[model samples]
Target: MTWGKVREIRDGRCGKGRAGDGKESGGGRRGRGVETGQSLTLQSLTQWKVPDLGSGEGSQEGERVKSGGICAERAIAKHRAQRTPISSKNSSDCPRTPRHSLNMGIFRFRLMLLCLIGSLSHLNSSVADEAEDISHKDADEAEDISHKDVHCGVPVNISHGHYEYLSHHDDDTYLSVIKYACDGPVYHLEDPEEAVYICTEHNKWKNAKLKYKLPECHKVSCGVPKDIEHGHFEYVTTHGVTSYLSAIKYTCDANYHERDFSDEGVYVCTIEGKWRNTDLDFEIPTCEPVLCGRPVVHLETHQRVVGGQMVVNGASPWSMLLRGADGEIIDGALIAHQWMLTSAHALQGEGRSEAEIKANFHAYVGIEDAREMDSAHEVHIDKIFTHPKTKDAMVYSNDLALVKLKENITYSNHIMPICLPAHDLAAPGKVGHLAGWGMGVELKPATHLLYVELGMANASQCLHQLAQKQPGLFTEDAPDLFCTQRSALEENVCRGDRGAPFVVEEGGVEYAAGILSYDEACRAYTYAVYTNIYNHLDWLKEIMANH
Candidate 1:
């Protein structure tokens, strides 16, 4: 018997023992009735063959094999071995129930087989229904996953950088968002508020820019520098790029300088994207107009005398040296961009004519030692204006003159003009400096320049002192020149010192108080006659205005 049939018997679907499945069969025979050649089904079972175990023919079949289903396979094997006609090739020819087996009744056996087949068919139907339901469930889950993938587009990408999601999400739904960022120093968000984007209607992202344009990742930058009032700036590193790590240097224009001494005017890009000077913490440096009369140097504070110690470089920036066509050098003072003050007699020195003086008249400055004049920037003289009341070269009254230069000067620390005095009267007892050209009185000219300090004397003292030399030149009431006397009664202010500026410092600014006009040939001691500079302010202003 097949395992299926055996299971049916084990389920108690055999003989008269079953009630709900079908009617009784072989009421007391203690055996199952089944059809050997018919396929089982729930609706049909009339072709069963029942054996007569009461007769010797049935007894010889399986009494020794045991009738209980506990040895069902062994009993079936022995019973099939006992088939008649030596078990013919066709199962129908194997055996047949004799007419005596009709005692068990064909109706009863058919009832048993029908009930067993019906139970088996119901079990198979339930399993197929459950399997179909599972298949449909799996297909729905797969469709949900595929639909999510097709709901939205790709992620956003920015120039110079990438991005990431602000928060995890199951799908790119309407309201999903991403936050944008950039590599430090090298790149940054142009608008940080726009760094985040939200998925809006139509499955598109939106930010402060409104459109779905990827937020820009621009190179970090400090914009073009602030414009200085009298200066400008230039790049020190890669040109045309104001991005991260850029460098720049600021410079003042001609005749201008940075007001703050601490600021070096060199700047660099910072990590936070600001331009800053390495040594200073202030904002952009400013360029102010050069303050006149202030020397761009530090000097020794000791007192100076007549023909005293040598002056430091940059200490007397306004002091000038003039050379004529005859190669004669004298001292002069730069008082403005194109105007200089000097002694009128120095203009006509060496007996040269006015035309000869203007032919190759050049001014040299910025050097104390003449040998170091590697760049002798020769500024040509455009014109000369001698005082209207000035006498001959041998006279001392009205001895001051003005020289106009052909080109305008761009002032610097080494070549700046001195400030003019505010009042026109020579202040009595005020001390002043007189720079000396080392053309020694009886000796050859020296390369280095020297300076001396002198005190202005009262008009009576000045006039009394001058009367001893040029006796008839002036009186106390209306002296033609003022006197400056050295405290130390040492060497005299002589010929080579002609045209030197008597510079006085007031309120930290140097001003031309007088011009050397009548320093005798080393004969007069401790005192020199200078053409009054303050008294000639009106004439100086008028000449400069007309020019």
Candidate 2:
């Protein structure tokens, strides 16, 4: 009755004959329907007795099969249960089939039922094994998917910027949001709208506004500052660093601001990456000189004059006196102990030969009064060197000359040399002074040294003005020549003003900024042109080096 260790005594298949031959075998023999231990069930269903019929003996019922070939066993060993029951009389009922026949039919039904139960048990075991394997496979696939869609961690850091997480489930998990900001006022985000990013479900950090792309942190750059006309700018934030939200200061050169324009202190690099003045809309400030009328100026009481004003003695120690034998006086600048700067045309006095002019010309320094030549130090000329490109024309472009003195002059309050244009910044529209003994009233030479103040005007405007008087004199683009502001006075520059030293004072020091190259007719609305000393520095340095 141990079902687990039961043996199959019938054929492996249900409702059939013996496992080998189709014959009915007798009791006491096992069937071959199944493997060894599976061959017997209920002890082969044979040793018990059935009701005897014709012979009053036990029939060979265990192996009996009907013509239809279905097994009908009627007897088996009931010894274990130790009980056997024969059908009793059914007197009133129709006569029953023989008791043995009835027992065989009941046995057959029980045998078939047991075979079916065994078949179902095997099917259930196979189904359970398959179900367990499918469950394990599903778990493995779920694990791989969990690894692939992992939550995002902290994103990469950006230069000049930082990020911080907003409300989220975790620091850098999915659906987390982060805000971006620049490191300082000197830097800005490239895109403000994209400053917030999200940790996406796809395990990536993405911009809040964009679907797939990651957010970017970019440092702003305000490229190179715009070029200022007649002026310059410098960075106050950092050297050679124009990027970020930096700052700058713009300033005009010397003489550039006579009256109109003024300085704007702080120019800043904006979030949009542009250089701009927070107060003004202009990107660059300009140094523009007024051409027609005199630019209004604030002059010191002692220095209020511009048209041949007489000053105290030794006021212009660097002013040189150049006189012709026929009493012609020309103004010059004393540059060194032995060197003097003048107009190249000064060497060509009207009536004197070149050799005679060199020998007879008298040069003096420390002369405030033209009439007091005896008190001035007279230096004889050792050599007369005019610029090689000097033109003896009405409008001289290279109207520069140097006179080498025979003796080395000593420096004193009344006889000092002026500085060369080296490191001297001559700003347009800034006033500069000129010292000379100009031709006085009615073509008479002045009895005292005179000086005048004039602004250094723009070269382009000066050329235009000068071209109206002498169209062929200048090409209007003279690089070495520069002009002064027009005088509103009746006589500002006259005949005796030629080669006068134009001194520009900066930081308490005086520099020889120009030499008078043109003389206007001593009338109102007249402007004079000069040779720019800065442009002639190379030639002067070359000459000084050679000497």
Candidate 3:
């Protein structure tokens, strides 16, 4: 039977009872000899027969039906041959009816339809799953782009002094430049101070090791020491640069001598950038006058040679002439073998340079006459330890200064050091002796060393006189100062006698009690101000010990 006819017959038969009868309801057709409710097999479907159309039962329509039924039977037989037969206890029990055959054919067609529907559903589900995977992949790509935008190609911040930044082409690598500050020119094991720094991908600047091989930039300097007045210094390492790890040494000029101190006179730059002593116990080096031993004494009378009447030669062996490039500037006392006591004003040149100051002054020791320097010892000034307060005020309030000689003065008969007083022993009415190569009664320079006897003046009397003479200059008598007045006419120290010592005899030994600081122009009744040396004894001892 044709496929369309078989479908139409199967539908018509299914509308009837579910029995396996081959009976046609219309025209009262006779039932086929097949039992109702019987199971059909592949053999039954194949053996089903089509009625002959030439028997004239239904004429032309019957012929058409018979032809379709014949084709349907042939198709069923072919399908049966390809399918496995169902095994049963009685194979012959299966019916050979066309109705059963039609029902079997319809059952096979429905199974195939269900299978096709399932396959189509599975294919659609697979397409949807593939689309979801693609969407997730796109999202991941976008996330990666966002991450790259955040971290890459961003600038770093660096704000240290003398430091600069340099960038590299590779994003993971960077470089920075460092500049020299106060501590460097040479850094890191004698390496030329390079300010360059490198940063790797893993080695960030936060983890970088910065080694400060040199001293810190701030605290590094060997400034001019007040004690080193007459000598010159130079850096042994780098000139004009006093950075860390540098060295400097000092030397005295011709005829000048350095004190025999423990220090080797060399200073090394420390990590703090300051010049420090190798031993750490001392400070800068010191120089002093060369010693010459005791002077000659008269054997018979136990007295030295006398000349110039009261101004006798060698009467005041501790007296010294402080000479400048021009002439005698002031007088000083040899208080110690290496130290000289002077007035602060004697060294004052407020606007002068260091070179000018050094070129101007020198110490002339053991001289009976200022003009005769042949037999005298010329000692160069090493360092001048001036009072810090005096230097600030630019005045003579604390007008005492100690001069360190280039070499220690040898104890000579004419160049012996005088003793300092034990206390502020200035008593009013006590007589003190002052000597210097100053203007005499005639206001002219003396031919020889001049001497005078002056009486110590009380504070009240001295203050009254000073206030009357120069108002606002000597407002009050400072504790470190004392005044002296000539006991007789023509016995007065004049303008050139500044820095001379006022000596008092105690136990037959002269002790320096004051430093001659200032005096009015020589007058009939003259009084002079002197810095009380006793008050500054502690400062003197301390400076002497360290320097």
What tens-digit string does per-residue lDDT give for candidate 1 at 56-135? 43354334322322233333465688763322233323344444334334454466666756767777678789998898
Q: Runs in model 3 with CA error above 4 Å?
A: 1-310, 349-355, 391-394
Model 2 backbone overlap count:
17
Per-model C-alpha RMSD = 20.8, 21.5, 26.6
Tally clashes: model 1: 0
Task: State the displacement of the C-alpha of residue 166, model 3, in Å, after optimal TM-score superposition.
Answer: 99
Q: Which candidate comes out best when scored by TM-score?
A: 1
- State in Å the error of residue 23, model 2: 99
Model 1 misplacement above 4 A? 1-251, 258-286, 298-301, 304-307, 325-327, 372-376, 440-444, 471-480, 489-492, 521-524
Q: Which lDDT values do the candidates have, in the order given? A: 0.68, 0.64, 0.60
Give residue 311's lDDT in candidate 2 (0 to 100). 54
lDDT per residue for candidate 2 within 370-435, as digits (tens), equals 666873478788877778786553446888878888888765435567777666455678777777
Better candidate number, 1 or 2, judged by lDDT: 1
List TM-score per model, in order. 0.49, 0.43, 0.43
